[model samples]
Target: MLSSKIIMTPKVKISYILNIIIVLVSFTFGFRYIFASAPLNYQLEAIGVHGWNDIIPEYRNMITTFVRVAGVGMTTASIGMSIVLFRAFRYGQNWARWGFAGIFLAHYIPLMCNMFFLKTTTESNPPMIPNLIAISIVLLSLFFSSNLKNCKAIENK
Candidate 1:
């Protein structure tokens, strides 16, 4: 019988904790967008676009549709990331390490850039601090999980 246990170092433990935080935060925002449409509405209101649904029902519907779709995407992706992180990353798989970083960068870098992009076009102040903090957490997680040499128990498997 093959045992499925992998020993955890301090760095790996920290990585696991950070990954959990990422999943929790992602799910929170995702669910809020999906169920309440609060995030996009907040952004719209910040830009002084009040009563858009009353003034322009069609446009509001379209934007709401987009927000809900984004929410679904975020939620689903978070689930996938959790699976990868828990099953493979904790085992110190090299592929999982790079894959997690790549997925995070691919998903978030463009969104962060778009936030700044929107700032130039609209009067809205994009939530830069939260995005920065999220990126920092992910980077720290990656740093902790990378180049670990103590995962030899499962390294050859």
Candidate 2:
């Protein structure tokens, strides 16, 4: 039947769901953090404040560039990934498969610090919530990535 033509694989379905969730997380928390979190953290007297006495551009450049680059990448990628996720639902396209993998890596791996500890660089750096969401997304993606049916199997030119 036409209704049964779609695969409805749980793995692929979960991956699609997680992709949507990831998009929301990025747009809400990630975007807000990019615009405000770093400056707020620096403003905190408790964060070991060093005044603008030296104003060393090298150190400033290093730290600021790292934050800015990562923030911009997250913002742009989240938007793109959301589009890809929608495409996956309809056509199960090759780009979405690979895109999901990349998003999983970028969002998830940074959460794992060393073997045990987790690193969350948000302003509050709130206990485990930030990283927990990321970890959950990672697990979901891994469980449902449908990587076995990746670009190689699909006809993409």
Candidate 2, pairs of clashing residues: 11-144
The clash count of every prediction, one per candidate, is 0, 1
Worst lDDT run of 10 residues, candidate 1, spans 148-157
Q: Where in model 2 is the C-alpha error above 4 Å?
A: 1-7, 37-47, 50-69, 111-129, 147-157
lDDT of 1 by residue, 51-152 (tens): 555546676667778778878877886887787787778666667766676666777788788888777777778777897898899899888887644665
lDDT of 2 at 49: 50
Q: Report the C-alpha lDDT of model 2 over 47-141, residue by residue, as the tens digit.
A: 34555334466765555555566567677767776766665533655456676657756754663442123123423332355656676765667
What is the lDDT for 33 in model 2? 47
Report, for every candidate in turn, its global Cα lDDT versus the true structure.
0.74, 0.56
What local lDDT does model 1 show for residue 32?
78
